[model samples]
Target: MTYAFGDTDLAARRLALLAETFAPSSRTFMVEAAHTGLRLAADLGCGPGYSTHLLAGALEPAHTVGLDNSESFLDLARATASDKVSFCCHDITTGPFPSGPYDLLFSRFELTHLQHPEAVIELWGRQLAVGGRLLMEEVEYIGTTHPVFTSYLEIQQAMLTEQGNSLYIGPVLDAVPDPAALKRRSSNVQTAPIPAERAAAMFRMNLGVWRHNDFVRRTLDPSDLDDLESALAAIESGRSAVSSVEWGLRRVVMDRVDP
Candidate 1:
């Protein structure tokens, strides 16, 4: 599966901002859903190690391994590796994971990029030790009144649709029955209100990553994209303050039910 967002330096920077924006929600999910005494944890699709570090800090697992396909991101992740925290370059979607049957598996904003998320979840569940938990955080809804924000989302959703993915994949996952060896423990939406400027900054950075995408160039007018980018930049720079964007994140926790 191709990542709509490239893994360039700019993309890494955007992910950094994204990690900062969503850390609170992810931390709360870990605190509420994960049990103590976890021997090992894996942060799937870890980018630049931010989420990996977050997991280590929150659960304090005896060992934590972050897995991703991008070597550049892994390089950054390894730079800050600790005795208890390490990273592996592996495609998380296809795994006989290099590591073990983890006590916990965490992924944030990852399922949206996948084609067969349910199958992937099942694969991940099988890699977990019996009774281990899998925590997933994904987009349920993004509520925004600003025109620029709405426009950006429309284009993004369209592009993802073309790729056989969904930008709003939370409700879709909610409908998926528990995958083999995994039983649904909890699923709920947590609303996070992002400041207009912060939201604009994120949107602008994301637009920069995918504006050159073939689908984007084919489907959107160059002038319109230019306008949207400028508008987002204006908001991000504080020259314009639009209404805040509210994200309803679906937080799902599942427990391994079979060996």
Candidate 2:
């Protein structure tokens, strides 16, 4: 399994953005979906555990498990472990789920990386207890008028396609076993403005992540990547002035039906 953007500094920076700009809305959506009586919850692809921690606070699951395939990320999650929250190392696609019949199973931006997301969803659905809910959040599209970000996204999309993954996996949610069980709770295009310095750092980190990848080199124009790198450095060094760096993100939330 090739995770083009694995657990790295770039992933961490992106996680920060998700934590600050995305998770609140997602938590609110899930909370409204199941107002009370949420007992156990699992966060698939929990990464460094931001969403897992958030789920713990929002649902107060009696036992919350943050599952991921990366031991490095699991180590980071375990460091912040609490009585109610724990970390598990397991890939959601093929590995055995830790223990389920859970009150909630949640994942974000994870489906896009998998070749068989529907299969994973079916397996996770079986783990839900009666009346339990499955919630997922994924990017429908990333829109940006910023040239640098747009160019970066283009390359990113190509890289994902090369890896047999889709950066836009929103429509695949419909392929779940019971189409009626998936509810499209929210869909919108919004832009989160990041400080120029922080945005520059994020771009640099991602470029670093992709720079060494053979697929990236073979699939994208080398000169363009170099130009983007230089452009980001200029943006960071005050050679260029950007009023605000924006990320146009679209997200959809799906809820599993009660059985």
Candidate 3:
């Protein structure tokens, strides 16, 4: 699948290919304790309706809003929006987030995609009601310490800096726990490796990012586009020694501490 923008949903689909995808230490991370009692809930950037389905299932007793910027994605959500759930196509970066004193708000592997993740987090925080919970699970690529992945990451870092951009994922993960410049919000941040199976799947799903990151396309292999695709595939293989070492994945759970 192409990761350009609608990649989150594509990645989510690839993750649930197996039955155990969301089984705790599995390919997906979702709360199963039942959210039916929540007065309101939302899964912002609920691409492809994967998480939308999960949220709707859990919040069956309440109205759940699925907000996203892609109409193609919202269409997928509406197909499953029976009665307690509905999809809203919107560019949350601007305009209003649907009305919510929502008791719970979440996004899986979602926040890091924004150029202004901090600002976006602040916005979501604003929509949260008293005693509400805002949780975001993101890729917190802590280190390039893996023996093989370090090279690719180093190259990525330099390439992004040259393009006047940062690597964007891990750094933001580190910042979520600190709400210093954000709107009045108290939060907690935690990180852990997603299951190897799921991690590899998500990375593999976005196999095209190497070409989209500008740094990889313009600097890493500017003269060898074909070689770049080959490398991306290799790194996503999970089993290939070189790929396993080069592509690593993890998730962060950021929660807006309930008052």
Candidate 4:
């Protein structure tokens, strides 16, 4: 499945915010569930290594492998690598998982892009060592009291739905076998308090990524895209008011229990 947001500089910046907003709590939950000691870990769809870096720092694993299909993303990820942190370029869906029997396998916002997420989970289950953990996070829904951001999300969800991905992949976690557990959490990523200039700048950069997406171009109206651009510009210029945008998230932490 194609990523709705291609690997680009703008996409990388957005992902940094996305990870920063959600990954801390995810790490906390994983630590609690896995009981604090991780020897080896794999970060699936590591996406510019934000989450991978987090895992490396928090767990201080003997080895941390960050995997992604995007060469561009991997290139950036590699720049940040240390002796303990390494990056590999490979498709998470079709390629073999990076050499493992890993203590922890983590993915964020990636299941939604996969056609066979359950199969992937099963693969992870097999690769995880006994007492290992599989941690995942995905967008449950995007919400806002603001009208313009709401419209933006509606359009975003429409494109995702058309591509056969769900904005909310939380329910899919239930279908994974026993030993896996799930929880819902608020990302606490607020939109309103953002300065008009910064919000506009961020959304404008986001729009650039959206405009380049093949699925979005094929699915979203050209005029609607133009209108979004104008609206964001207006909000940036203080000509419009929009408030309180946030994304709800679901966190799933599955422990591998050997039968």
Candidate closer to the true structure by TM-score (higher is better), 1 or 2: 1
The lDDT ranking, best first, is 1, 2, 4, 3
Q: How high a TM-score does candidate 3 get?
A: 0.66
What is the Å distance of residue 189 in model 3 from its true position?
Answer: 6.5
TM-score of 4: 0.83
- Candidate 1, residue 108: CA error in Å? 0.3
Per-residue error at 4 for model 3, in Å? 4.1
Per-residue CA lDDT of model 2 for 40-143, tens digit only, reads: 88998998899999888887878899999888778888998999999998888864578876778888778888887776776776677655677777766664
Best by the TM-score measure: 1
Better-scoring candidate (lDDT), 1 or 4 = 1
Q: All candidates' TM-scores?
A: 0.98, 0.83, 0.66, 0.83
- Looking at model 4, residue 141 earns an lDDT score of 60
Task: Record all residue pairs in model 3 with backbone atoms less than 3 Å apart, i.e. clashing.
Answer: 21-28, 149-245, 149-246
Model 2 TM-score (2 dp): 0.83
- Steric overlap count per candidate: 0, 0, 3, 0
Off by over 4 Å in 2: 174-200, 221-223, 236-259
* Local accuracy by lDDT, each model: 0.92, 0.73, 0.54, 0.73
Considering TM-score, where higher is better, how would the candidates rank from best to worst? 1, 4, 2, 3
lDDT of 2: 0.73
Residue-by-residue lDDT tens digits, candidate 4, 131-173: 7777777766655556677677676667778777776676666
